[model samples]
Target chain A: MATITRVGDPADPRVDDYRDLTTADRRPDRPGGRGLVIAEGVVVVRRLIESPYPVRSLLGVPRRLDELTDDLAALPVPAFSTSAETMAEVVGFHLNRGVLAVADRAAPPDVTALLRDARLVAVLEGVGDHENLGALFRNAAALGVDAVLLGPRCSDPLYRRSVRVSMGHVLRVPFAELPGPWPASMALLRAAGLRVAALTPAAGALPLASAGLAGERVALLLGAEGPGLTDEALDAADVRVRIPMAAGVDSLNVATAAAVAFYGLGCA
Target chain B: MATITRVGDPADPRVDDYRDLTTADRRPDRPGGRGLVIAEGVVVVRRLIESPYPVRSLLGVPRRLDELTDDLAALPVPAFSTSAETMAEVVGFHLNRGVLAVADRAAPPDVTALLRDARLVAVLEGVGDHENLGALFRNAAALGVDAVLLGPRCSDPLYRRSVRVSMGHVLRVPFAELPGPWPASMALLRAAGLRVAALTPAAGALPLASAGLAGERVALLLGAEGPGLTDEALDAADVRVRIPMAAGVDSLNVATAAAVAFYGLGCA
Candidate 1:
């Protein structure tokens, strides 16, 4: 059973893991950073509890803690109950979510392993926008993608905003940085016997549904919003596929496109 | 040919239409409101110039103005060029896009007239969130949705953020409020010979793709992100469809779900 403790002071040493959260969460994955996985609100906190990461503790007001009592009863972690003001002062921001949980960052999964056993894996390059990154994970989780493979220049998906925006799916979805060359890193998916399809809006590109991806093991390569996949990345792909859009239209938001593609691939 | 005027002062009365954009755009369609449609950036401004709405004026920096010279050359409207700093001061925030355009709200196309010819349309209810409402329009446009019909409690699509998020497609795609009794108002679409398909995550929903929506003229009913379609609205729909998300997952974001359904309807 988890230990429940009452903490009145905002500056208590025991709750340091929850201190100055806004600043600390900025570069949790950077050098000299703790890289803690933080989950906010009851739903996300519940997700963090169930994830593979090791949870250190939790801080929240009584009402939130009371709501989570059943979940806490099953966890072995400590739960600190405090006032909202104290929680706000401790975290340097009024966390409207009422509760926060922090867990240690787990190691990246094996790329070949994830690809070999996966039906649909999203391969991303230069998708640096945190919100889009988070939304993509949420879609990936909802659409039943087996894994997400990170390409070059992608943001750390564990960033707090991404974590929150993803509704904590960033922690649930297995992701690993594609640890090799730029465009050539794509060969890893091919070697694992998965077709690599780059999503583009070019006129000559084959329509997504007809790209022969339905029921195939596919690693769909996605890029940042405006400057989509680089030329080299496009050429490296086994084929280029487009979501047929109306004429004279700008592209759909990256995450939205990924959701449609995921639905098309996953459900087909 | 459009008249080109150079304004050096931030407080020029000629550019008053562009002042206090953050607040001015809060209620662009309400009582005593300016009822002006504003588009930001060159891309959107260009779209505004091309939309059915009557262009009131254009305020932009020299570079953006220069980029639009070809389009401007064909118009009789005034294009006011100003410094970025001056434009920023007038706009109540940093004008990073360096351009803005304002136009009168065009009279919406007759609801019956729009439905008469539309192969596909989106009917929204309680979609008060501006960004979602805007993203829905963008999705509708990308999927070649014929028009949008607002049922009730929907936000103004011409709001500045909506216009921006819709990538100015809000100006292109026609949307009209569905008047008359709440669910009964749906008969207008039925009168237009379009079948109304409501989307929900309820267990009884038919998976979108297998529902035979493709190759059919249909109207899709959508709702706010959290609450989804009202019971009355659901009852009014001819059929209920779902995206078939994984078990125990919350429903997809309203706009994302709409996109999947729209594509599933084979609008492309």
Candidate 2:
């Protein structure tokens, strides 16, 4: 059984990982910065417990801790119980979610290994917005895209805002940064037998439905919302496809577009 | 030609319509509440000018007003030019978009009239979240969805947040409230020779790709993110279809799900 300890003082050394979350979250080089993945709220905390990451501990209001008793029973990690006010003092802001869990990052699965037996995957380029990145993973997971390979300039999917917006789905989807040089590195997928289909709004591209991607071992390539894929990236793809859109309308938000593409090419 | 006037005072009665946007947007019953449609930023401001809604006036810093000079040249409306600092004081916040336009709410197009000759339409129920509702319109417009019929429990799409999130497409695509009763009112769509296809995650629903909705005159019914479609609504539909999703994953965001459906059933 996990030990439960009451922490009355915000300065308590044992609860140091829970301090000044707003600033600490930005200091990724610090203990809780990029070094640790932080999950807030009960739903996300549960996901952290089940994710590949190693759970450090949990801090929550007494009632919130009580709600996770069953999930904590098998783990021997420390669970800090505190009043809402004390919790807020340590967290820097009053978090209405009432609970939090922190964990260490785990080794990302190998690219070739993850691609093995995978029929559908998303290859992302320049998708630097955190929320958009997070929502993409959530959609990918829901639509059954096997894995995500980050090309160049993608943001950290584990950022707090991303984790929250994704409803903890960033923890569920498997993602790894693409190894080697940018566009040249894409040969890795082709070598692994996945066809690279770039998604664009360009008029010349085939409509997603007619592109004949749904039944294949497809790796959909996506770019940032505004400045879409670079010329080299588009040239590298086996085929280019687009969602047929009405004239004069701007492109859909990046993540929304990705979900549509995922569903279109997703396995039935 | 539009008349341009220089305004120096924040409390000037001429700009009262633009006051305290944060709370002012909520009191839809108040003078500027539901009575007016407010468009912020140059892009949306331009859309408001092009929309059927009658533009009453505009407030902007000198640079932004100058930018709108060509679009405003033909309209005989007041354009108040002020400094950014004074504009902020008047609006009760820093209006970073640098321009604002307010227009009177126009009469919603008749339901039967909007449905005429439109091959694809979306019939929404309980999609009350403004951002989701707005994004849905953006997707609908991009995918050539002809119109939207708001059923029960839906929030006002003209709400400021919705307008911003839709990137002003809510102003472009036509939407009208579904009149008469709840799901029973859907018969009008049937009368218009359109099939009512409800989207659900139920096991028995046909996969969207295999449902053969493409190229059909279909009104895709959507519910809120959680609770999904009501039983009465589902039972009333001509056919039930679902986007195939992976096991253990939660349902897709209501708006994202709609985009996929729109693209799938959209004209080639």
Candidate 3:
């Protein structure tokens, strides 16, 4: 069971991990940065506790903490109970959801092992927006995509905004950076008996319904909303598919497009 | 051609329609409200010019107005050219998009006429969030949904936030409020030769892929994220279909789920 500690002072060093969180988690890979995985609100904090990442501690108001009694029962970390005002002071902003949990980042899963038994995967390229990346993870989790592979220029799925936007599915979904040079690294998916299907908005691309991808073990390559998949990435894929669109419409948001492809490609 | 006039002062009465837009557009239906339709950014501004809504005038920085020269060539409204600082002062915030357009709200298309020739449609219930409402329109446009019917508790699609978040697709996709009492109003869709398919996460609901709705005229019923379609709404539908989801995960965002259903039901 977790230990409960009352923290009245916002400056206490024991609660330092929860201080100035907006900037603290921005670039954890840089010097003097702590790469802590943060989960905000009661629901996400519960997910952080249930995730593979090692939970360090928790901070919340009394009422918010009471709501998580069952989730904290088996958690061995220290739970800091504080006033909403003090909690807001420590976090550098007021959080409407009240409860929060922080964890240490875990090593990503091996790509080869992750793909060996996977049926459906999402490989993202240049998805630099944290919210889009996070929303994609949430969609991936809901749609039953077996795993996610981060290609070149993709945002860190573990980033704070990404974690919150994904509703903590970033913790539930296993993701790893696709190592090696750009499009060349995608060969790993081909070797694992998965077809590499790139999603694009090009007029000549096969419509998703007619692409014959349903029920196939496929890796869907998606790109950012505006630029779309680079020519090299599209060329490397076994097939290029598009969602049939109305004339004069630009395209769907990247995450929304992924959900459509995930459903169309038989992820469910 | 638009009449370009130099406006050096922030308090110019000619630009009253574009003043303090954030609050002015909030409750346009209330007393003392102008009830204007606002479009932000060059892309959305161009859409406003092309839409049925009568463009009243435009407020923009020189650079952004210059970018819209071709769009403004046929427009007869006043174009107020101002510095970025003056534009920000009038709008009550920093206007990063550098352009704004206001138009008179046109009468909504008749619901019967909108449904008559529509092949695929989306009917929304309790979707009060402007961003979600807007995003759903963007998805609807991209996925080829022919029309949208706003049910009870739906936010105004012409609301400024919805217009911007939809990338102005709200202007492109035809929509109207489903008039009459509650779920009973849905009978109009049935009379129009369309199936009323309510989208839910119920376990017993038929999977979207297996629902056999592809190429069939469907009016997909969607609700807000948390409390999905009311029981009364669910009971009124011809069928209840769901995007197959992984166990332990909550439902997809309402707009995202709609996109998945739109694609799965063969809007593409």
Question: Could you tell me the lDDT of residue A194 within candidate 2?
Answer: 94
Summarize candidate 3's per-residue lDDT along B190-242 as a digit string, tens digits. Answer: 99999999999999899877787877799999999999999999999999998
Give the per-residue lDDT digits (tens) of candidate 2, residues A1-268: 6799998988999988778777566536656464568899988898889899899899998888999999999888999999889899998989999899988888889999988888899999999998899889989989888899999999888878888888888899898998999899989999899999999999989988788776689999999999989999999999999987889899999999999888778742
- In model 2, where do residues sit more than 4 Å from their true spots? A30-34, B30-34
What docking grade applies to model 3? Answer: medium
CA displacement after TM-score superposition, residue A209 of candidate 2 (Å): 1.6
Report the lDDT tens digits of candidate 1 across residue range B1-268.
Answer: 7787999988899998888877676664554456678999999999999999999889888999999999898888898988988998888899789889998887888998898889999999999999998899999999989999999899999999999999999988999998798999999999999989999999999988877777778999998999999999999999999998877567888989989888878733
Off by over 4 Å in 3: none
Model 3, span A158-185: residue lDDT tens = 8889999999999999999998998999
Cα lDDT tens digits, model 2, B194-229, are 989999988899988788666679988999999999
| Each candidate's clash count | 0, 3, 0
* Candidate 1 ranges beyond 4 A from true positions: A28-32, B28-32
Identify the candidate with maximal lDDT.
3
Better of 2 and 3 by TM-score: 3
Q: Write the per-residue lDDT of candidate 1 for residues A161-248, one digit (tens) a residue.
A: 8999999999889999998898888878989889999999898899888988877899999999999999999999999999889989
